[model samples]
Target: MSVPVEVIFKRPEALRDRPTHYCPGCPHGIAHRLVAEALDDLGLRERAVGVAPVGCSVLAYNYFNCDFQEAAHGRAPALATGIKRGRPDTIVFTYQGDGDLASIGMAEIIHAANRGEKITVVFINNAIYGMTGGQMAPTTLVGQKTTTSPYGRDPEQIGWPIRMAELLSTLVAPVYVTRQALYTPQLVRKARKALHTAFRLQAEGKGFTFVELLSSCPTGWGMTPVEALEWGKEKMMAYFPLGEFKKPEAEEGGKK
Candidate 1:
């Protein structure tokens, strides 16, 4: 008798079969897969609506299988707020990069989370602006070199990198906020578990949920994919510690 073959790995149905345009070694693909898998696991693919504003993540609409809305630069949270408010039954989320979320869209994201919108947010922090020619972003390391900060980011002149997870956790309205990384398989599994928690909490009509993913940008960082991943684990994780900054208390009242 012929040996039978078994399939152990396959793409999640929540993600389209099309190849992604992300650079070779980019962690955005990993993040996408995790989100898609979470949606599949939670049976929220059909009800999910993703908002991708201008940034490296702007193309997420084409990658995900569910409904997506393109928003202006730094305005994804605003768009997601409207979507969730208009259609309360649908699951809503935003995939935003550091440049899009921590820079120009800072106000929008802060206000949305402050208002306690029942939506999930996936923040991808690569430090440098990946889609816009390696410019320095709000989360750029203090001594990191970017096109905008050729000499290096100076804390005295521009201030230190922002800790988004820690900052958001300070807000009382948000129900859950966590920081995870995609540098290693073990970390990736943890990140996926966080994603599942965020999505599941959103489904339960919990208040604002945010998961900040420490992602790698090899092209922008001018490093090989392997080097970038290592760099992120060593340098990026040092600045943005990975953990649950905030979580809803047991039976705590969550805003709808």
Candidate 2:
């Protein structure tokens, strides 16, 4: 008899079988894989709906095996709110970048979280805008150089980088809020756990949940993938430390 080998790795059924458009070493691919794995593990692939806004992952619909909708720039949260409300049985989520979530979509995200919409949000904070150009974003670290900030970001004029996880945690409605990263294998594992928690919260009808993943944009940052990951661990992690900012009570399946 021939010995059989166990399949240790394979694409999640929730993710479409297609090559991603993300540049080499971009963390978006990791983020997508985590989301797909969560959907598969949670048995939500059949009903999960994703909302993708204008950004690097704007083509998200083409990648997810589940249904996906495109939202206007900075408006993914609002769109997700509507979808979740109209189809409460469906698992709804929004994948947004720093430029779309923290900048133009600031108010939309704030209100949606405040309202406790039954939705999950996957926020990718790469610090600099990656789609349109390498421009300064609301989450850009101070002294970080970008196309619009050739001299590095000036706090005196641009203000400090917005801490979305901390900001959203201050609100009363969100069931869970966390900041994670994908720079290392260890961090990537934690990020996947956070993603799973956010989705699990929504599956249980626990109000709004948000997980911010600190990602690297090698092309935008003008560095190799390895260099970007190193920079992220040294600088970005200093500003956006990874941890759960908030969670429901332990009795309610959240961290104490």
Candidate 3:
């Protein structure tokens, strides 16, 4: 008698059935998977609409199975706001990088959070620009060298790195704001839970939700994959501590 085979694990339905173009040790893939898993688990894939801005995840549409739209550099929040407002039934989200979110799009994100738009945002922070030849980003750590900061980022010369999760949490409109990392398996699990919480809040029609993921960029950082993870755990994690900066209250979940 022939025995039936059992399937143990599989890819999330929210993800496309193809390979991603992310570089080795690049945490964008992990970020994508986490978002996809959350969407799949919540049965929100059909209602999902992603807006990806310029940066390493500029081509994010190609990786997700749900509807996706592209936005100009540093304009994802604006586009996502329009989408969510126009189609309130759909779950709108923005996938942005530090270069886009903390740089030119600062005003857009802050106003969006302050307005309490019912949308979810996934911010991948790798400290350096991953798509534009490894340039220094707004979240780049002090003393870190990049193409733009060839001699290393000097706090005195340039302003200090902006902590986005904390900044957004200070606003009254956002119901949820958290920072997490993907350097190790344990941290990745926590990051996954954070994503789930953000999406769940968004689905419940809660106010703005944001999840900042401290990711690794091996190619951009000019380090081996293993070395990049180690460096990120040591350097990035220390600067961007992981945990919830803000969360919803009992009454915060009542709005539709």
Candidate 4:
């Protein structure tokens, strides 16, 4: 008998044919897959609009099959808020990097959360800034060396890495917040589920939803793809714990 092929290997309809621009071993590709899968799961492909930020994954518009908009550096949240409010019927999502979200766009993100913008935010926290070379990002861990911090990040000089999920959870307006990783098959599955929940909240007209994905930048981290995966589990996971920080209420008032 011939071996049967599984349907799991097929690409999602929400993914376009354009070859990915991410560097070999870069986790951006994985993140894209998770987002596409979420859209597919929620049947939101046609009505979904994605905002791409100015970073290494700036060209995310090319990979996702849904409508896409380019936002100015660190302004994705503001742009996404406008898009979501203007087209309340559609599902709006913003893809941002650590540098874009935790740095220059910090105010926008916090205020959007405060207002409970009904949009989904896919935050890719890869520690270092990948687009303009491997510089220290706001999420870079202490003792982690980047181009801008050859001596490693110091809490006294640079302060500690920002925990976006925790910070967003403090805001009362957000309906959902979670941190997930894409380093392994199990973790990837969890990340997909988290992404799906975020989009679901958007579809339900719930408040803001944020999913911080701990990803790797192999080229920037100066490690091979395999090494980077190991490093993410050993180093990144310690700082950014993976779990749901908040969730929508149940019909009876309990946590959903």
Evaluated with TM-score, which candidate comes out highest?
Answer: 2
Candidate 3 residue lDDT tens string, 204-238 = 99879999999888998999999999999999888
- Per-residue lDDT for 1-256 in model 4, tens only? 9999878687898999788878999989889989999999889999999999999989999999999999999999999989988999989999999999999999999998899999999999999999999999999999999999999899999799999999999888998999999899999999998898889878988789999999998989999999999999999999999988888776223275
* Candidate 3 runs further than 4 Å off: 251-256
lDDT of each: 0.93, 0.93, 0.91, 0.92
User: What is the number of backbone collisions in each predicted candidate, taken in the order shown?
Assistant: 0, 0, 0, 0
- Clash count in backbone of candidate 2: 0
How well does each candidate superpose onto the true structure, as a TM-score? Answer: 0.96, 0.97, 0.96, 0.95
TM-score of 4: 0.95
RMSD of each: 2.6, 1.5, 2.5, 2.2
Total clashes in model 3, counting residue pairs 3 or more apart in sequence or in different chains: 0
Alpha carbon deviation, residue 24, candidate 3 (Å): 1.3
Which of candidates 1 and 4 reaches a greater TM-score? 1
What is the total number of backbone clashes in candidate 4?
0
Better of 3 and 4 by lDDT: 4
| lDDT of each residue in 182-223, candidate 2, tens digit only | 999999999998888889888998889999999999999999
**Cα distance off (Å), candidate 4, residue 234:** 0.6
